[model samples]
Target: MSLLSGLPLQFSIDVSSLLNVVWLGSIFVFFIYGQRLQMYLIANDISRALNRLKIMRDKSRKEAIDYFTSSGKVTGDPTQRIDEFLDYVTIMPVDMDPRGVVEKVQHITNTRDERVRAEVSQIIPNLDPTKVSVAENILEIATSLNQIHKIVRHYYLLGKKTNSYMLLFQLQMIMPMVLQEADALVNAVDTFKLGQPVGDGIGPVIASRYMQNLPKQVVGKDTVMTVGEYKGRTLYVLKAEGPMGYVGEPGVAIQKLIEEMKVPLNAIIMVDAALKLEGEKTGEIAEGVGAAIGGIGVDKFKIEEVSSTHKIPVYAILVKQSILEAITVMRKEIAEASDKVQVLINRVIEEKTKEGDKVLLAGIGNTLGVGQ
Candidate 1:
């Protein structure tokens, strides 16, 4: 009382207590405000990046459509032109933290705002069974894997303990199986073998006894026969019939076809099965001139030299899959050859055949007996 004699009784509280309260309140306010600022910055950056990506994608799409419909006739080789468009589109800087984006979108979805949810769903790629049943199945498996990952992360966060050893051992065993399953799924998605049912109507025409009996020779198990009618056009379609690693061997058949068929060097198109990325929808096609066919020594080197020397336009159509699972993912640059190529995705070969399309269909992969 003597120390606070000059002040009112209410103002004679402990100086230390008063200072402590003031300091704590200031810190609390600062922390709350700082957190809000950080969230704002992150949201703004994500929004900007997404908007930029959309602009680039739309621009590329328009360019492609314009080129296709500009002239009454499809000119300048559709395959080459499509490839060029894809190269321009993929060059856009759209990659961000996929997980963070997913989380942000999911939060919006939970708000039950129909418009917002619908917009977010487009970016997320709906896991509807009708669109892609396999993708839906994989999503279910991913959910289980996510749970397992969480348990492992929790154990890791805790300091070394008795159960830690058991957890580590279990994680080690589970990882390989998870990886194997992922690989299998990616392979299944990448290697799209459209069933023979779709090929029924067209197959009879292409496989009629008259066409089958044409001048043909079994060039090392692969029947090389002349079919289509193109005067002075000796079209040789090289269908790889070997193991996965033997894509280069087909080049030999190709060289022989060039020499025997005497086909114009510029009219050649090398078709092969290619692995696509997760974002690439199945049946999406593009055309590019790239050396995707793998092999060592003479097989690969020779093809490159020959194609280059002839100044012939080479085109490729790659199927999409996960890069983590398949090392042979299709190259984006392959789509930027000349302005004459077109790479069509998610294309049904059977459907293409019905349209009277004379395509050099190259099933690029380890062709170890049909269903790989």
Candidate 2:
């Protein structure tokens, strides 16, 4: 035993020397290929995000196809037809001259809207108008998700192919926010499918509440108006006709009320949901001046142009919420904000317009799952 033990510790290692060698090897490897390793890591992250986006995009597309086929309205498989609609693109009007550009933009956008509506209607001819609106909304969401996925994939493949760290870095940085948006849109698909009121419906909800028991007439395309007296002032309240997903032609409605209908208005009061900052409360209320509408600037431009021509004072009451909350199902807090908005509207009207004055009240936003 003693002789065997003395034969020596052949496996013994110098701990300090071993650690130094390992540390040096690691440093050497990283020093030579650090950028490559980082690029691989970043690409891996982006690949994962890209996969998620594809899933979301495909899910919404399937939802749209299912919605149409299950309606029993179409005779054949509508997958190809629906796919064509998803890939449809609208070329924006050239803005070089910047003169009469608004009208040009408006015309182009209106045409696009009509075309989209007609295509959807043709596909599901027997579906109710309300249900058709829902299908359109779902398709719109799907289109958006598709666009996002394509864009992400394009950048990812390009970045990897070219080994562009800057490109990859930029894309990686934005992926989180992009994914959040895609997720929100995915959630909105369910909300639209169910035809439930969303946070954006807050504006129409307030208008409908005030419009109770009042006679409303069609003012514009899918838009309605009701006349009522509040605090000794004639209040003309208008909102997008609903219980379906429709923003209607709110700008057109307001313009018609003033210019075509010859309603001499002392003041214009607008209420809409506004995107809130990160720290802001969900149902926070803010009052401002201007056209309180959100869209492709067609509606806002119309309102601004007309109100300026008449020198009418425009006031805005906004209910703040996040972008996700705006499109998804209506939150309890947002629903409660409607009551507060009504009170705020009263105060604005009373303070801005004198007794015996006429004021146009435009509640602007998508009117989904909300009534006239």
Candidate 3:
């Protein structure tokens, strides 16, 4: 009774009002806290996802060290290109489709190619023919890094359209992971001094090996293709020649070989690197019928155009690998896959061609680490 008497008069007579006040206050507090809790949870999830991506990027970086060392090509630190390359990224319009966008990319690539060649020539007067490949790789690595930054930044800006703070924050957190990937890619490419194979080089590797000990003829301004006998078939093999900077004008070379060289091709076989599925093994080779090439489709179009006119059956042999495997230092598995692919090519020729038939076999892709 003494303690109760010390309380305010309102506590004595306003019991229902006080209880109502407390109940409303509790609801308001919970509403604010619930929103805050949800924000934190979402933020936490985004952080976790970004962290996983970073881990994958880090693993890729570690693998790159070995790739560079084994290739025996990279000399100086090529990593400096990656940082300066960011300024070169093209800001693509959000409304544009990717199909048309690569045209601009090709233009950018060509410019870089010219710039790199000139720089290399200037640095080492009467440059060693072998060093040309290294220069090309440096320029290509710069372009690739720039493209990555362009892609990530483009999307990050697009996300800003929503005007959501949380969304922007999520994208911001993921940027470093992408940059890390760019760094890894640049280092690996600098190490290899060849365009990352990206499954595209398989065809060239096979073609070069097949053409071994055969006479190589200059088929185009920059193309070195071979005409030789393989398994009782007269094989006209075309690929971008290398060991000096070259991925040859394959599209132009193929068109000329059929329409101009008039080889009387019985069958047209294209071997190239193919993108593997998520669960697919790296360096797995598959045989089938189709173009089996990945690029701006210029080469594929020319091949199809000439083959269609001549009524030749086009066959495909695809070497499977992930984008990473294809573009980074040439992996041993991929190198092994090349030998296996040659066996398959021989089998394909035997099954598809008759004795003395003139056949045109094209190893289509960048022939950086390959030769005629």
**Leading candidate by lDDT:** 2
The model with the greater TM-score, 1 or 2, is 2
Cα lDDT of candidate 2 equals 0.90
Each model's lDDT = 0.37, 0.90, 0.66
Give the Å shift of residue 127 in candidate 1: 43
**lDDT of model 3, residue 203:** 74
Model 2: per-residue lDDT, tens digit, 1-372? 976885555334466668889999999999999989999999999999999999999999999999988888975888998999888888888888999988898888888878878888888897898898998899899999999999999999999999999999999999999999999999999899899999998999998877889998998888999999998999898998899899999888888888998888899988899999989999999999999999999889889988999999999999999989999999999999988899989899888899999998888888999997
Count the clashes in each prediction.
33, 0, 6
Per-residue lDDT for 1-372 in model 3, tens only?
A: 977776777575688788888999989887878656655555555455445544444443333434333445555543443334324444443435665544565555556656666644544445455555655455555556545545554554454455455665666677656655565564555445543443456677788776888888988746787778977888888887665546666767877887787678899888888878879888888888866666666556667777788888989988787666666666788778887877778888898889999887888766665666
The alpha-carbon deviation from the true structure for residue 266 of candidate 3, after best TM-score superposition, in angstroms, is 1.2
TM-score ranking from best candidate downward: 2, 3, 1
Q: Number of clashing pairs, model 1?
A: 33
Off by over 4 Å in 2: 1-18
